[model samples]
Target chain A: MTTTSTKGQRLPQTSKRSAKAAASDKRPDEDASAGARRRQIMQEAARLFGTRGFEATTIRDIAAATGILGGSIYYHFASKEDIFVAVHGAGMEKITQAVLAAIEGVEDPWDRLEAAAVAHCNDLLGSSEVPVIVSPYYSESLKGLRETLVAQRDRYETVVADLVEALDLPPDVDRSLFRLNFLGALNWMPTWYRPSARLSPADIGRQLVQGLRPR
Target chain B: MTTTSTKGQRLPQTSKRSAKAAASDKRPDEDASAGARRRQIMQEAARLFGTRGFEATTIRDIAAATGILGGSIYYHFASKEDIFVAVHGAGMEKITQAVLAAIEGVEDPWDRLEAAAVAHCNDLLGSSEVPVIVSPYYSESLKGLRETLVAQRDRYETVVADLVEALDLPPDVDRSLFRLNFLGALNWMPTWYRPSARLSPADIGRQLVQGLRPR
Candidate 1:
C-alpha cells in the first residue's frame, strides 16, 4: 500500500525528470523508437500544417512525410485534429516556457515584458523545429478548433497579461489592448521578417518594446 | 484620324467616370448582368477563400457558391488562381483608396498615419465586401502565389511605408520596422477582435496609434 502511494506520487513528479531520463526509464529500446517516431510525426505534421494548412493536410500526408504507414499514425494521434491540437499545444508550450524563463529574474515590468518579447520573437522566428504557429489570420474552417487553440494559447497570453498589468501606464490606457497590440506586433513578424533583414529577431523585439515604452 | 485620336483620349479618362455611368454607357442589360455576375463571383470567392482557403476552394466551388454553372466561371476568371489574384488585388485597391481618401487633407505625419490606421482597421474589421486578405503567416503552399499576392499588396505597403518615413522618429529607430510592426498590430486584430467588445474598430485603431506615438 505504501509502495502504491509512492508510485502515484512519482508518476506526477515526471515533470521534474529530464525527458531523456524519463524515456530511458520507460522501456529502453522500444521507448526510444516510439519517442523518435512520435517526434518525426509531430515535426512533419507541423511542417505540413505550416505550409499546407490544417484542413489541407491529411494523416496519410503526415505519415508519408514521416515515412511511416498511415495506419501507424492512428496509434500516435486519434485524428488529424488531434495532431493539429498537439502541434499547436506543443508550440504554445515551447513559447510559454521560453517567455517564462526569460522573465524569471526580471523585476521591472517593461524590462520583463521586453525580455519575454525577445525570447518570443527568437523562438518564433528562429530555427526552432516547433516554431510558434500563430496564423496571420484565423481561418473559418478552424472555427470549431479555435476554442481549443485559444485555450492553449491563453496560458502564454496570461503570462504576458500579468507583465502588462504590472506596468505603470497612463490610467486611460487599456491594458488588454496594449497587451494584444504588443503581442500582435511580435507574432506578425513572420509575415514580413526575412533572414537577411537588417534587424535580427532580438533587435525587432527591442525596437517594438522601445516604440511602446511610455515617455 | 482626328475622331480616332479623340476616342482614344476619351477611353483613358474612364477613371473619372462613375462606375454606374461607365456600366450604363456599355451595352446596358448585358453589361449590367455581366458586372453583377462578376461582383457576385468575387464576393462569394472571397468568402470561400477566407473560409476554405485558396487551394481547397475550386472554380466549381466558387461557381456553386455564386449560383452559376462551373463552366460559366471561366467567362469571368481564367482560372482559380486568377480569381484569387483578383480578390487580393481588389482588397488591396479598396484599402489603398480608403487610406488615400482618409489622408487626403491630413498633413501631420502622425495624424495621417492615424487616419490610415483608422480606415484600415475599420475596413479590415468592418463588413467590407473584400477585406484585406493578409494571411496570419506565409503558407508554404502559397509559395507560387506569393509573388503575385505580394505585388498586389505592395501598393498599399508603399503607401504606409511613405507615411512611416515622414514620421519624426528618433534617429536610432528603424522606420521600416516601425511601419511593419505598426501594420502588423492593425492587421492582427481579426485574430482577437470581437464585435461585442467594448472598443469599436475605430477605437481600437486610435488606441494602437496612440500607443505607438513617440513620447
Candidate 2:
C-alpha cells in the first residue's frame, strides 16, 4: 500500500513538471503570434490613416478591421500613436536596410549611388505594401512619432548624400543638385505612379539612375 | 422769383450729377483694392494651410492671420473649401502656364522637355515667394479640387508623353519610362527641397534634363 501511494504522488509530480515544461515551450509561439497580431493591426491602421488621415481614425476602426474588440488593441499597443510610430519606424528601417544592402558590394561610387536609388525605389514602390506616410502631414497630430520618423529619414538622406559626394564626377557637376534631383525623382513616384502603368518601378529606377549618372 | 426757383432745382440736379461722377471715378480703385485683398487672403490662407494643414485651419484662423474679423472672410469667399479650391486652382494654372509657355518656342522635343522641366523646377523651387499648394499630401481631402487638378495634370502629362513617343531613340529605349523618370525627378523636388540648400531649383532641373538626354 505504501509503495502504491508513493507511486501516485510521483505521477502527479511528473505530470505537473511536464505541464510546466509545455507552457514554457509555448511562450515564444505566443509571443510570435502576438507580434503578428500587432503587425496586422498596424498594417490596417496604416491604410486607414493614409487614406483618411490619422486624426480621423480611431482605435475602434483598427480593431474592427482586425475583427478584434476595441479593448483588445490595448493589450498589444498602448495607444494609436504607439502603433503609428512602430509602423513608420519599421518602414523607414526596412527601406534604409534595403538601400544600404543594395550598394554594399559595388566599388564605383556612381554604381553604388544607382544601386541605392533603385533599391530604395523598389522598397518604397514595390515590396512595401504600405502607403508612404509623409511626416509633415502627421506632425501636428503625432508630434513625437513625426520627430522620430524625420530623424530616421535624415539618417537615410545622409547615406545618399555621402554616396553622392563620393561619386567621381566632372569638376563642374553640382553634387548638392545631383543629390536633390535624385531624391526628388524617387520621392515623387508615389504621387503619380500607378502599379498598372507601363513602366515597372525597377524600369523607372533604372532610367532615373541613368539620368543621375555623369554626363 | 421764377429765375431763383429754376436755379434752386438746377442746383440739386448738378449735385446729383457730381455724386454719380465721383462714384464712377472710384470704380477702378475699388476693383484694384478688391483684387489686392483677394490675393492677400489667398496668401495668408496658403501660409496657414502649408504650415498647419487645411482642416486644422479654420476661417477664423485665416481671418486672424489677415487682421480681419472671422465673418469678413465669408464676404470674399463662400467657405474655407472655396478658398482652398481657388488657391490650389490658381497655383496649378500658373505653374501649368509657365511650363507650357516655356516649351512653346523650342523645336527639338528634348529641348522642349528640358525647357518644361526647367520652368517647373524654377517655378516650384526658385521663387521663394510662390508656394506649391497642390501637394499629394492634401489631395485626398480636396477631392473635387483634385479631380479638376488631376485632369489638368493628365493634359500636361499627355503633352509630355506625345513628345516622348516622338523622340528619335533606339528601339530598346523605353520612352514611357524615360518620361516617368524625368517627371518623377522633377515633381519629387518639393519633398526634400530646402530653400537654404546649396542647389537652386533651375540648377537641379538642368542636371536632371542633361542626365535624361540620350547618349
The most accurate candidate by DockQ is 1
Pull out the clashing pairs in model 1. Answer: A135-B136, A136-B135, A136-B136, A136-B137, A137-B136
TM-score of each: 0.88, 0.72
**What TM-score is obtained by chain A of candidate 2?**
0.79
lDDT for model 1, please.
0.79
lDDT, residue A59, model 2: 81
Candidate 1 CAPRI classification by DockQ: acceptable
Candidate 2 lDDT by residue in tens digits, B1-215: 11111222223222222222434555767545555666677888987776566766777888888887666665566667877866766676677778888888789977877788888888877763436574555535666566766675676678778867866666766776677666766766766678897767777777777665665
Write the residue-wise lDDT of candidate 1 on A67-89 in tens digits. 97776766556667777777788
lDDT of 2 by residue, A52-123 (tens): 566657788888898887767766666678777767766776777888899888998877877887887787
TM-score of chain B of each: 0.85, 0.76
lDDT digits (tens) for residues B58-119 of candidate 1: 77788889997776766666666767777788899999999999999999999998999899
